[model samples]
Target: MGFDEKAQNKAQEFQGKAKEFVGDKTGDENLQADGAADQAESGAKKAAENVKDAAKNLKDGLTGN
Candidate 1:
């Protein structure tokens, strides 16, 4: 099956949240930082996806989708 970018991003976001929670519970500073970084990366990817689709839509509009 083709990879779903949205699903991937959501999964990453969820994972980051879980890690952040676990790290906080365990008092692991490194894990918490990693989780925060992961969350940022996932958010950036989602934003990129939004930009990509918007560009595609603009192209389609110009060409008639």
Candidate 2:
């Protein structure tokens, strides 16, 4: 994936981690769940981007681009 996407994914993961930590400290189950959801969403996004990038590379290689 590109640098921008990578950075965004990292930021999202970090935000989730912070939320989870705060939720644990504050004893908020909902916040903890939200944090976990956020991390999962970010991971999905990154995986999608990686797949797209791999597809593009495969196409380029096939076309000798």
Candidate 3:
């Protein structure tokens, strides 16, 4: 919902992508799984933030913010 949170999520997603790439190249299944999990977690967090933002927007609109 904020710049800092968005930046952190983007960083985490990027890190996950790098890990996944390295794991695939080196044939490390565990690392690959970890990377996938990280990506999923980032995605979930982003989604939650989006929902919160939408709710806030709706409330603000109703209250004439």
Error of 1 at 37 (Å): 1.1
Which lDDT tens digits does candidate 2 get at residues 1-65? 67897899899999998888899999999989888888999999988988998999999999999
Q: On residues 1-65, what C-alpha lDDT tens digit does candidate 1 reach at each position?
A: 12686787888999999999999999999999989999999988877877988999999999999
How big is the positional error of residue 10 in model 1, measured in Å on the Cα after superposition?
A: 1.5
- Select the stronger candidate by TM-score from 2 and 3: 3
Against the true structure, whose lDDT is highest? 3
Evaluate residue 4 in candidate 1 and report its C-alpha lDDT on the 0 to 100 scale. 86
**lDDT of all the models against the reference?**
0.88, 0.90, 0.92
Better of 2 and 3 by lDDT: 3
At residue 38, give the lDDT of candidate 3: 86
Give all TM-scores, in the order shown.
Answer: 0.83, 0.83, 0.90
Q: Cα RMSD (Å) between model 3 and the true structure?
A: 1.0
Point out where model 2 deviates above 4 Å. 1-5
Model 3 spans with C-alpha error above 4 angstroms: none
Candidates in descending TM-score order: 3, 2, 1
